[model samples]
Target: MSTGMPAYDESGDRSRRPTATNRTAAQVNTTALLDRLRTAGPQSLSALVQHTGLSTATVNRLVDRLIDEGLVLEAGRAAPTGGRPARLVGFNARARSVLALDIGSSKIAGAVTDLEARVVRRRRSAIVPGDDARPALYFFEALADLAASLVKDAATGPAPVRAVAVSVPGVVRRDTGRVEFAPSLQWYDLPLGALLEERLGLPVRVANDVNLLALAELRHGAARGRRDVLTIALGTGVGASLVLGGGLYAGSGGAAGEIGYTLLGRESLSTPWPGFGDLESRVGTAGMLARMRERTDALPDGFGPEDFLGLARSGDEAATAVLAEVVDDLSLTIGNAATLLNPELVVLGGGFGRAAADLLVPAVRRRLQGRIPLLPAITGAELEEAQLIGAAELAIDLAAAAPSPPT
Candidate 1:
C-alpha cells in the first residue's frame, strides 16, 4: 500500500456510525445525484432518470428542489422535434462560491470558484521565510481576506461561502484533518484541518497537494470520464493518484498513492537501492535537483531542471544522458504501476512533468510498448491551476456532504 500519512479522526475511531438525517435515505441519494449532475455538467431529465435509475417523476421532483435551492438552473432546450423542448439543466455557476487554497513550498495560491468550479479570482504570493508555523497562518489570513473581497464584489444576495479546500505539500488525513508528513513545507503531524477550520470559520478539507491535483484532473482535466486513472506529479516530489471506479482510492489509512517511495532498483539493478532517504530526500522539486547534482558534474552551478531540458533539446550529449536517465527511471516506475493498477489513463503533471513533456511522454510510451498489455494513455493537465481548482471542489463536496445546517 502507498503510505504517507494516517487519516485523522477527531472522534479517535477508525469506524464511525452514520448520522441519522432529517431526510430519508432516498432524499439524500437524490440530493447527491443532483450535485453530481451539477459538477459533471448539464443533463436532461431523461438522462438523469436513465443513469440514476430513478423514476422520471422522482427525478423531476428532485430537479425542482435543486432549481428552487439555486443549485441548478435551466440553460436552454435540448434538441428534438419532440412534443415539448427538454429543459437543459446544469449547475448555477454564480449561485455561490468555493475557496480553494494550495500551499506550496515556494508560494501560496488561492482561487475563488463558483459551484461549477469555474475560477473567478486568483492570487498567488511567495512564502516569506520565518517560523514555518507562521507562514501557514499568515497565508490563510490573506486567503480569507481575498475571499471576502471577492464576495463583496459579487451581486449575489448573502452568498454563503460553501467551504474552504486546502491542498498542502504533505500527507493529509481529511477525516481528522492532520498532516502526517509534509517534506516540502517541513511540517509533521500538523493539525492542519481543525486549525484551519477554526481560524477561517469555514469547514476545511485538507488533502495532499498532488492528490488534489489528481482530483482536479479527474474531475475536469485529462482524466475526465475515466474510471481508472493514474496521475503522476513529477516536479518537487514524484507522487501519484490512482482513481478506481471514478473515485480516489485512498487505501486503508489515507496513505495510498505515495508512489515516489516505490522501491526502484530491486529487480532491475544489481545494487540494492536503499531508496528515498528522508523527508526532502525523495520529495519535491528540490529533491530531484539534489539527485541530479549527486549523479553528474556536467550541469552548471546554478542549473535548474529546465536548463537540463534545454540542453537535452539542443542534443548536448551530457545533458541528454542525464535527462535520459530520469526518463528511464520514470518510465520503469510507470510501467510497474501500470502492470499493477492497470489504469485506463496515466496523466503526467506538475511543473517538471509539464515542461519535459517532449521528453517524458515518448519515453513512458516506449517503456511500456512491449512490457505492458494495454498501456495507459498518457496526457497532460489542461488547466494551470488544477490542484487549486480541485481544492475548491473538495471544499464544496465537504460542505454538501455535511448535514444541512440548522434552518
Candidate 2:
C-alpha cells in the first residue's frame, strides 16, 4: 500500500519537499496529549497512552519534556488497581501568566491571567475618540504600565508574563501583526503589535476584537465543543467572527470574518461615517439611536441603545418600532450570512447584542425559520469579558508554542 506522502525529487524545489512531516506529526501528538491532560485533570502515563493512542514511550518522553518546561507536573500517584499505584501527571496551569489587552473603540482594558485564561487582575482606562497626539502610543504605554502593576501586585513577586495578546477593533494582518484598518478607532496601517511588544518588552499577538470574542466562545462560552460557529458582535458597530472546523479561520488577508463591511444597500458617500457598511449603518447602536430620535422626541435624556431596548421591552410604541426595524435589519444581515456559511451555531455578543438578545433573537429566529431550511441555535455570550478572555487564550497558545529554555 502506498503511504500517500509526497514524493521526494532531487530536482524539485527543496521547500516543496515534505521535510517536516514527522516533526509536524510529533507536534500534533504532543498538543493532543497536553490537551487531554489539561481537560481530564490528571492521568497516569498508561492513561495518557490510552487516551491519545500514542505509544507509552512517546507519552513518557513528551510528559518528561513538558515537566522540565514547567508546563506539566507529576502529581501524587493514583490509587492502586491491582499491585502498584500509577504516577499521575497534570497540566501546570499556574506556571506562568499572560497579559491581555482589549483595545475597544471607546476604551482600553487590560487583564493578567493564568495558563487557563482565568483573570487574576484587570484594569481599564477610557480613550478620547479624537486625540491627535500619539493616541495609540499613549494607550500602549498605559497597557504596559497596567501589566507591570498587575505583576508587581501578584502574591508571587514579579511572576513571569509569557506573552501579551491584544484585541483590536479592526482588521489585523496576522503575519505581520499590523492593523490594516480600524474605522471606529480611526487606526489605519499601524504596526500595533510591534509597538506594544516594544513597550511591554514581551512577545505580542494581535487580532480583531470580534475574532477574539469568537475564540473565547469556542473555548469557554456558548460555542464550546462546536465547530462552524459564527459570533456576531453588535455594539458601536457590527462585527463577526467565524470558527470553521474547530479553528479560527483567518482568511488570506486575516479579514475573513469582517461581515461588518458587507453591503446591505446602496452606497452613500454623504453618510457621516463613510466606510461603515449598510448593515451596520442601519442596525448598529448609532443607527438605532438615530432612527429612534427621528420618530420620537419623548426619548429620555442621555438615551442609549440599552435604554431604548428597555423602553421597547416595556411596551413603549415608538421605542418598539425602532427596535422592530433594527431587528428586521439584523435578521436580514444574519439570514444572509447563515445562507452562505451555514454555521452550526450563531452567537450574539457585544454590548448591544447581549442587551437586546431577548428581543432580537426570537425575531431573528422567526425570520430565519421562514428562509432557511435548518436554523441554528442563537444565544448570547456566556463570558462577561470575552475579548480579554480570548486575548489571554491566544497568549496561552503563544506561550505553549514558545521554545523551552536550555536546562
lDDT leader: 2
Q: After superposition, how far is residue 194 of candidate 1 from its true place, in Å?
A: 1.3
Q: Total backbone clashes of model 2?
A: 0
Predicted structure 1: lDDT: 0.68
What TM-score does model 2 achieve against the real structure? Answer: 0.87
- Over the stretch 1-407, how does candidate 2's per-residue lDDT look in tens digits? 01122211010111111222374665556656666766678988998888777788888898898898888998999998897999998988887788888987667888888888887788888866365587665655665677667655653644477788889999898766789998666678988888767766677888888988988888788888786888999988889988776667778888887776666665544454567777787888988888988998677789897688778989988888988888778777788888888898899999889877878888889877868766788988888889999888777766664556454
- Clashes found in each candidate (C-alpha, N, C closer than 3 A): 4, 0
Residue 117 CA displacement from its true place in model 1, Å: 1.7
**lDDT for predicted candidate 2 compared with the true structure:** 0.76
Clashing pairs for model 2 are: none
Q: Pick by TM-score: which candidate is best?
A: 2
The positional error of residue 291 in candidate 1, measured at the CA in angstroms, is 5.4
Q: Write down the lDDT of every candidate, Cα atoms only.
A: 0.68, 0.76
